[model samples]
Target: MHRRALLAALLCASVPAVALAVPAPPRRVVSLGGSVTEIVYDLGQGGRLVGDDLSSLYPEAATRLPRVGYYRAAPVEGILALRPDLVLASENAGPPQALERLASLGLTVRRVSDAPSVDSLYRRVEQVAEVLGVPQAGETLAARLRAEIDTARAIPAPRHRALLLVNRSGQFQAAGRDTAANALLGLAGQDNALAAQRGYKPLSAEGLAALAPEMIVITSASLQAVGGMAALRASPGVADTPAARAGRIVPMDDLLALGLGPRLALAIRELKKAAQ
Candidate 1:
């Protein structure tokens, strides 16, 4: 072959090999956690989502998608039926057996951490974006989220000691130091009364009294479960607490309040407003 023709032939051969080596981005994705789904939507990759879990209830439109079930108990059959090219899950999104079984199916299952901190949240966003082949979008979202969080944190620290409670049928469970609720309280500049406790635990009348929270944060679902704010205040143990007595109760959406996702900054802002 002529020198120029040989060079062109070599270039064409290399191009085909390079193209064949690159994997196509996942087009049909499944989100196995609420925060995972929220991050995807925030990154403007919602169009690629084919299915999600029960916990993926943000953005309203996510609810319209087919559900594979709750993250922890997600059934392999339901998920495989969706024919997902990729599945993004939270760190705690499965039983060990289920995840092991899933790995055998020759599909990509990415588990992002659910750590309750601003840094971890940003990392999770980046991880999802990388998987979706949109690293730039992820970077933009992370920067915006950081700025919003900083703005919320600029508010003067509240003097009140607050306890976040999850009330289910009048039974109160307090969110402790390691939880997303505690992280939110810290961002809002309120002292978490249950910070000494490691994780969520049921609070007795004595426990509540010792904590002596001046304000109480409750979820909208929990508040409604016990028949609203009035009913929550009237509940035996809660009524005796300073928060209930002083009418210092704040209610927020369950996912937005507890989930460490795109809504985290908003959650902090809402908590700050309610604290004030």
Candidate 2:
């Protein structure tokens, strides 16, 4: 079996059967991840959200809630202050100590895995909804998301090598295999130009030139960091790339590109269009 499939199966089997039978749905909830927050809203339980991590910027109203801090560095005190009956977080959420502290305080903290793939995304939505006592909503949302993603995945593949990168000052950070960006690129029918690598890492001028990607995908935030699209093309090392010459730079909102949330299908479609 595929590694992700094995992990998903193990994750599903590990859930306690009795937990699915919680007597009362949590009325006060704190979300500690962007995708977790989006799933809550998609489940139609946004009103229950009393707080969220800084990453929860989608759906606008989520921004009005008190922030507990960044997902990885959340403070237990801020979360406790929200008086939440339940906390929905990404598995990657936390400095272990803070989450341990929160758990010790007698709070129910449910963690959804952060692995970003169509299967993982479905699992995350289901996990969040189930913990919120809305399993049926989760099922429906997951089904819809799966269908939409399948449709997006059906688009004709563009036979082009594309590199998704983040530029900081003129240096580049490129996405590699097994990352959210790489998964989304495949879903959008573009081959990851940096798939030879395993994760994100700095891309030197020589490295970027060697990759010779036909297209470059970047986030709006990264574009701003290197002085916008025009400046990006003019930057040293990047100026020589075929992608820069062809103006094949695709810039998307960083959140949408990385969140792997409810809007993932939309992101995939947009990227596919850009690649084509």
Candidate 3:
């Protein structure tokens, strides 16, 4: 075969054709991302959700729905068990094989981008709304979100140095650039203390003091893991930081602090308040 033709054939062979199609308004839908689920509820069309991935917990009602598995590693069998007519996945969904299995088996899977940004969030809301057969609601929600985001951005940020941490198995992981936490801090006009690096990294006991952050942020779940504010303040090197010494450690709602979704403006406002 010609070189160009060979390359083209190889590309086609390597990529799977997974098309998403819904002939009518879907009566049963499975949401794979928290942001997607949030948009569905915000669009006032939560009644169509038959099941959700583990990451879809929000709005209180989402927790009560049957869960397939975590969005990032959803199980094919688990998703199949729900008998959904449409599966709306976020950009972070699946172990690749599971999603491919679903698609190859004829499940209509629509993937929405969950990139951390106001524009992306607005697009996500619109995408979810589109998939749910509520384009008007999606447009309205997107416009409202855009206006609220603009209003939030209009407020000058305090520009305080902030450090966000995730506690995993008793170990502290610092949020760096490209993370949801860092994005929120940036939008709120705060500097990410660990922005010198990309993605979450383990911080040494001595590192926090040297960074000298004005505020230390953590998720509510992480706070619970380390036994709350007192425990976090007592952790190694934590007390040495100006934030800890000044009692500036604050834990925010897990989803609100970490997920980019319909409540982004609210999160930004809360982050701004935390810096003060």
Candidate 4:
């Protein structure tokens, strides 16, 4: 036989005939954020979720999952014990050291960015779906959410200006442009009085007085901390504000309003009602 033919025959014999190897799917998944957990369940991968952060309270079933501690202060040992093949977390998840430890353990950790707007919220869903190998499911959910948001936006703009306040430990925090509150306000066809600002920041008494929003929207969880609507109105800084003077303060569930998950449609509806 010719040398070239002999070489070809040798190569053919050396390469064994076999089926291509298929990559194994992640069997055990750990979700480290409330929104992440919600998305995983929404994607129909709830059964794969072996562990979840304490904040993953929605969907009822998530509560029964193994608790992995708080989003930011997750216990590395507990996460490792779950033997998760994949870890889905929010961008803000961790004290840095904990995330590093998890990464060092060869865990596949993916961080989904927090969505502060309707568009960004859809993007977040898409991101989660991609990580879970369910891009179609993500697209379907995003489309549905977009339709609801469109319906909400179709409502006529409210006559009143609304201010969204994020109350934390009795301090007043204002959500500005590019925030979830601002997006919800837009969807509800209401103006964000603080739209000119960049992000959530502490508002000084003078700053509150200057804005004088027509309506005040606060997180329900902080109602007690801020002494409720009447007390918020009586605050020295906001006392003279239009929202305070008119007694138009509205309190909403923090998780629903801020989660930026499937409940965004509901959040928009409630905001629209509040605007009216």
Worst 10 residues of 1 by lDDT: 151-160
Error of 3 at 113 (Å): 1.0
Query: Between which residue pairs do clashes occur in model 4?
Result: none
Please write out the lDDT profile of model 1 over residues 124-220, one tens digit for every residue. Answer: 9999999999999999999999998898788764568999889755678999998988988888888898888898999877777778789998888
lDDT of 4 at 139: 95
TM-score of candidate 4 relative to the true fold: 0.81
User: What TM-scores do the predictions have?
Assistant: 0.94, 0.88, 0.89, 0.81
**Model 1: lDDT of residue 195:** 89
Q: What C-alpha root-mean-square deviation, in Å, does candidate 2 show against the real structure?
A: 11.0
Per-residue error (Å), model 4, residue 14: 14
Candidate 3 lDDT by residue in tens digits, 219-255: 8889999898887899887888888877778788878
Question: Which ranges in model 2 have alpha carbons more than 4 Å from their true place?
Answer: 1-22, 168-171
Instruction: Encode model 2's per-residue lDDT on 170-228: one tens digit a residue.
Output: 57899998888998888788889899889887998888878888888898889989878
Q: In candidate 4, where is summed lDDT lowest over 10 consecutive residues? A: 15-24
Regarding TM-score, does 3 or 4 come out ahead? Answer: 3
- Summarize candidate 4's per-residue lDDT along 66-144 as a digit string, tens digits: 9989988988999999999998888879978888889998998888877676666787789989988889999998888
Q: Which ranges in model 1 have alpha carbons more than 4 Å from their true place?
A: 1-4, 168-170
Query: Stretches of candidate 3 above 4 Å error?
Result: 1-22
| TM-score of model 2 (CA atoms) | 0.88
Ranking of models by TM-score: 1, 3, 2, 4
What is the lDDT, from 0 to 100, of the residue 230 in candidate 1? 82
Q: Give the TM-score (vs. native) of candidate 1.
A: 0.94
